[model samples]
Target: MPGFSFETAERTHVGCVRKLNEDRVLSRPEVGLWAVADGMGGHQAGDLASSMIVDALSSIELLGTGYAFLDEVQESVQRVNRTLVSHARLSRPGTVIGSTLVALLIYDGHFACLWAGDSRVYLLRDGRLNQITRDHSMVQELIDSGALQRADAPYYGRSNVITRAVGVNDRLALDIASGPIQEGDVFLLCSDGLTGMMDDDEIEAVLKARTADDAADHLLKVTLDRGAKDNVSLVLVHVEPSVDDTLRTARRTLLA
Candidate 1:
């Protein structure tokens, strides 16, 4: 945030099979906060869960430090978890209201990704793509344990069964990964809707478009072309030096 700025490209759509889109996306470049949430439940209950999360996050204030920002975000999400859990308890038996959460936080030249369930965050640095968040799903576990092959995960029958999510359990556990952000680094936050339609290689190629906006649009269009079976949502964030920083670099080069 000090000498860097962010540009975001985002979209959310109801896929071919779904009538109502259960996915929600938040792109707050000014606050350096962005997220993608995919809700899971029948009869539009998914919408409620995803919307509640994005609404809660949409109002966060970046306080003292980067660490405080992280804490506030985690607390806000946990609060929503409690609220949803209570709501489900008050409803009929076997009523499940839950959603996956993947949030990208940037502050003072640093970045952090907080998530639960199968949604993902990826970083493309120096033209090389790497997935930042590991999925919390049955298929992922099987792949990790060597019971299933990485190439076969997309076709895994139990792919939809996630191990963690808000509203699914009273104690919502979010995993956090953090590091310093670099200029030209691009961060992608998306629901499984996109990943389900393409492998990492395919996604990496698409993200290599001339601009972040182009890459984001192309990603969505490609998913729809593949017969997106679930609600699709994604946010592509491009990092760059601020105007002042760029000027400073130019000045130094001229002086040299």
Candidate 2:
């Protein structure tokens, strides 16, 4: 009720190549929780890791207040980490299982985002697109330090090398931020399979399409057409004023 939006649409894809999809998307319109997780590991472990993170987040109820929303997210992520580590060690002692989590919580026209790895969130508004989360990958760090130019980003370093991830590290250090939201704005949560295979320009073109489901399907199609080498997942949400505002106001007046 606090968040803007009386409507929503969402979609997810496993891509073309990988037999086991290691990506996950979760959405709760009522609570204004939307997220994406991309997992990394060997022997089908990646699939397990990413799903674990999503399930953890989905299980928790969205808090009634904005400040409590992030706390719920943090606690849920940590619980998933412990669970993943325990599961991985018991089943495959040497195998490492971890995942990147990007989540958005909207309340009272404000948004809070948290990132653990390369999975990302984008804000599209007024014909412009902006990437709101900074990646935790090796290549991103190099770019931040001015050691790598834009031309060299895709190939300069082990672009897959992530500095932080849920379940891989004992003590997780997540990047969290918050901001305001506006009507007619769109938010995208996607795995690297989409970002890795498509550039920002290409993504913007597809995301600007008519509807969220259409945009999501088009994006997935583009990834597959590009020879998707990994699993891909996407969640698109549009922010519009709630249509029920007038009805709710009348009810409030009657009660008063």
Candidate 3:
């Protein structure tokens, strides 16, 4: 498989209502990797936890034939979880630190995603938006169990309560999946900050704009304008069909 470079940009904001931003994001353009994380614990613990996850994942390299992308990601996440748990115990007693992680890993004309909690990844192609990640929250669980209607998810109580998150439990349940990519395709990795404030339609409209940087900035701005109740983070990536030899070699070595 050949290697490709991703053109990307990211932006995060405290928003109109939040006193401090707890969202964190990281991107590796050479590897075509990106991630968005939203912290759950109160105080600055959430911010620290989210940053640790990004830092851990950003260093991981996924490459080669039959490479273990999912395993590597899970390991990195676990390390971050441990770090968060240790920090919580030492610095902030009784402060449970956890976060939702949504990431994109581009490889060989396709991409794999690892998602947990309520953060999401959306695909934009041909002027349309399709949500690619499912939320792991109480509302989604009810929908799965036939206890709640899908259409009523927006207004459902406990909608913000996430079912799965890093550092929340000893073992985490993550939703992992893969899909094909196309030229001119745009991918969005965002926290609940944007999705909770703006619907899918609004996000698609802003993403279909001129460039990745513009899209990411606009998304954050729009969320804040709409009364961002929490810290907002967004990462926009445009994948093209071109390949880079250096990137391919690095990924190959990582796998080896």
Per-residue lDDT of model 2, residues 1-256, tens digit only: 4336735555566677778878888989888899999888967778788888888887878677888888988888998888887777787567789999999888888888899999999989898888999999889888989999978898865888889898886688889888888888889888888889999988887768768878877888888898988888888888877757657878999999
Candidate 3 lDDT over residue span 1-256, tens digit each:
5444577899988888878888899888776678999987877778877888888888887556324766787788987877777766776567788888998887667888888899999999988999899999899889999999988888986778988899877677778878778778899998888888888988888878768977777877777777888788889888764566666668999999
Q: Give the candidate order by descending lDDT.
A: 1, 2, 3
Q: Please give the ranking of all candidate structures by TM-score, highest first, separated by commas.
A: 1, 2, 3
Candidate 1 lDDT over residue span 73-129, tens digit each: 999999999999999999998898999999999999999999999999999998899
Model 3, position 113, has a per-residue lDDT of 87
Q: Which candidate achieves the best TM-score against the true structure? A: 1
Task: State the number of backbone clashes in model 1.
Answer: 0
Q: What is the C-alpha RMSD of each candidate to the true structure, in Å?
A: 1.5, 3.5, 6.2
* Segments in model 3 whose C-alpha atoms lie over 4 Å from true places: 1-4, 86-94, 243-256
Is 1 or 2 the stronger prediction by TM-score?
A: 1
Inter-residue clash pairs, candidate 3 = none
lDDT value for model 1: 0.92
Give the worst 10-residue stretch by lDDT in candidate 3. Answer: 62-71
